[model samples]
Target: MAFHEMLAPDYIFESSWEVCNKVGGIYTVLSTRVRTLLNLFKKDKIFFIGPFLHKKESNIEFIESETILDSWRKYANEQEGLKVRVGYWNIPGKPITILVDFLPFYEEKDIIYFQMWEKYHIDSTVAYGDYDDSCMFAYATSKVIESLYHFLQLQGKKVIAHLNEWMLGMAVLYIHKYLPTVATLFTTHATSIGRSICANNKPLYGQLSNYNGDQMASELNIKGKHTLEKLAAFYANCFTTVSEITGKECTQLLEKKPDIIIPNGFDSDFVPKGKMFETKKVKARSVLINVIQKLIGLSIPENAFLLATAGRYEYKNKGIDVFIETIYRLKKTYFDRPIIAFVLVPACLQGARADLKERLENAVSSQFPLPRPFITHELVGPLCNDPICEYLYYLNFTNEDDSQVKIIFVPSYLNGEDGIFNMVYYDLLIGMDLTVFPSYYEPWGYTPLESIAFHIPTITTNLTGFGIWAKSKGAKSDTLDLGVAVVERTDDNYFETAEAIKNIIVKYITKYDSSQILNIQRTSCALSKKAFWSHFIKYYLQAYDVALRKL
Candidate 1:
């Protein structure tokens, strides 16, 4: 490979805090991409590095295995004093994954931070909470990379180290300093300061260009993470983001325009084939309807519409605030059938509601609502001060017999054993007639993409990355006709955004009959096919090319 030509990577080391760990949207993004990545790169050459927590978690979730890199593993353990495990990740491709036990690095954190500050100018003193743990993991990942690079003799080869998020920012800086031969690509899913501003209820979109990221980070007390991310972006050979929306965010907040935009692509395998999809839909809808019926003690008709809003519990950021209000508006408007909205957000919880579980198990039906009919699980503290729960209370959702509109708060991860709805999130998602993620500050918005993949027409605002991409791909402006409704949203137009989403649903249900509805669902599935990694992997290849060319 020469400096004049675009270089192809012979090996790629993809590192993330959520490589095997199922945490957030990054997990979904990476796990789904392994198969497609393997198609372009050589087999067994792409390695994913993640943090190793404990023996039990490793044993349960990982399959420890032998690979050609065994020599490097041995060297890492004996010379580097690093606890590491080489295994196959339990996801789709089961890609070769190395989980480093980063706990040992805590003893040397101070020295490592000092070294980082000395070399890369990263500030670690102001870091708090998960900062130290993430940095330690990142440092350990860099060490693992160093050991593997020498052992594999990849010095002259096109070796690319792809690091994701600020959690792995240190790895980017470390690789650049220690292994200059290895091209580093650092992708920030979202700018730390941008997310912090939104999480703090500040108007991000309305005054984005005017806001100084450094100043906001200082005000938000996230300078450590912010500076780490900013410098990492500046240091990396290639800095990329998930979408153009986040690309602009990275430019504005991190002050470094991304080298490329690697839009998130879904795996077709997640969606069941032909009859399997319908079967899963039947099972999911059955469980969903049964749970709501048992809790609300109402006969939820077989054809009643099932709506959902699921994601991280960023109430204002994810537009859960607007969603709750939309449900109120939807309720105020007349609908001929029963409409039930499930808020599938994981939050602080004790356990499943014992009463609801018993009722679901017994197949009990009642004409009266339970004490806490609005929520399926019991929150940690007394009826609690949860925003969603409180807002529903504020709206007075009675789930009454004649109300025809009901909202249920499922404050648990729907991972097959939430004790109430024992189905996984996807299995449950396939059942939804419509999904809404009116996110105010969504960077990439995977929920809507997931919903559309499941062939469920979804409503999201233009403020989201997926929404922007969908619009560019000719997603209808104010209709569910294209399977996605990208509603207009701004910092101040909360009510308008909510009404727009509600109106899409209302119009969708009122205008289309059974056949037209099925066509729209199929159209959504087809649209999602355009976002499959098979199609979007070209962008990543471009990133890889650019990264190696810089070398």
Candidate 2:
């Protein structure tokens, strides 16, 4: 039995998007790891404390956590910078305590967005030059931690605050000064500055010589937050990054060295636990038809080859342009099928969205078959309209024929609405012949890993943190002949991408034998099993054990 299972603490407090809120990979970490973490500890011992948007309703009752309130009333009266409300509300089905603030920053006359949708308008800079809603988000997080610590102290429970990312890193720093007994654990999944420069193909440091250096510097100045990151790195009792490559980059690029490398893993159990590549032939075909039918309704070819690319909206960084160019060139030259590439890429579509759309369309010449000309299709058709309906409408629309060359560009935020988001993508992978992720910078890609898990051979670049690890572990790459191809981003030719796509499409169209396809599927399952949960969850419990021992 694990040491955590033995020690079974009185309480475990975790904060991230996944628990009650979810953003990206961090959400996965919180949801997957925290559940297992709770198993090691007691269920009642864990409390996930984070700011709840007042509009977002929860089943937990808002009983005045008099302990937290009393502690905060005293602390707030004493400190000036820490002037904030600290109270608790019970989340239903569980004794979940939510730490919230009703300070000047959090004061709202009327909450505009009750639903926790990623609102881009709120992301933009205000005319008054005030900070974005993210600042309030950061401030509220600090207050939450403060409130939780106070509650813990009043109960005489020793507390360990494990913070994920730089925003929470700041909160840890704030609370540590006041609470000496607190053990702080900080994890930087990816630094914003490192990611920005890497994605833009600029030097990680130093100005771009040809452009406005000052303006560029101002836009890319992650130094202020990173200083806090570095301090957390040096000061925190424990620090970890998601991948080994990212760990090195944190030290070398961001100057915030990580003490440990907790390479990210998926909750294998959450994904359909089955033979990874069992193609329910009829079910697979039906799913394929359902995906293609929607595109055909949009005038795309029913038999068009579907090669998908889905991720967050950083198009340039996610290598959407590269994926588009390859598809466009292939559609123009090779197989004369009507190509429909669906883009489920998400961005804050408030300002530059039109620009992003225009850029994507312009990149792919309008001389193709459809009125749009470019193959890139949105899961949610346009920027306007209710996204839920947009997602549902597409999901509900289906075609009679299943086979088509469809590429779905998925934006990151899927609220489990329209059931189609994750389901459709999975269908595309199992039914479609190929998936490509030509990322220039990925902290740790779940897409290609997911693709392989689904029994679809994927083309991933060397630049991705996962790809690097795969190469080290002898993950295969073929000249368009086998399952799972790894192409080096820096070394591979631009034409090589098109050539590879053509070869794969031709193979599928001409000679994808059942045995060969099944072999690929089985390979995917083998890979998935190799990276199972039992192998990794212990690391989290162990890391905490080490951290507490240090304390």
- List the global CA lDDT of all models: 0.88, 0.53
Count of backbone collisions within predicted model 1: 0
Q: Put down candidate 1 lDDT per residue, 324-393, tens digits, no spaces.
A: 9999998887888999998999999899999888887887767777897899998888664799988888
**Using Cα atoms with residue i matched to residue i, what is each candidate's TM-score against the true structure?**
0.97, 0.70
* Model 2 C-alpha lDDT per residue in residues 1-551, reported as the tens digit of each score: 55535322345556543345445566555554544454556665566666555565542334434564465556654763444333433322233455444345545312422211132122122112222243455455556666656655634555566777766654555556555566677777876556756666674323322333223324675444544455656567777787776776676655556766776665554345455434442355455444333323444434545566777766556777667666544543444564555555555433222423453334433322332222223333453353322432443322223423334434434443323333444544555556788776677887777776666667777667777766765665543334566676542355675466555555654576667767776776566555444556655655565555566
**Model 1 poorest 10 in a row by lDDT:** 1-10
What is residue 424's positional error in candidate 1, in angstroms? 0.3
**Every model: Cα RMSD to truth:** 1.9, 9.5
lDDT, candidate 2, equals: 0.53
* Candidate 1: C-alpha lDDT: 0.88
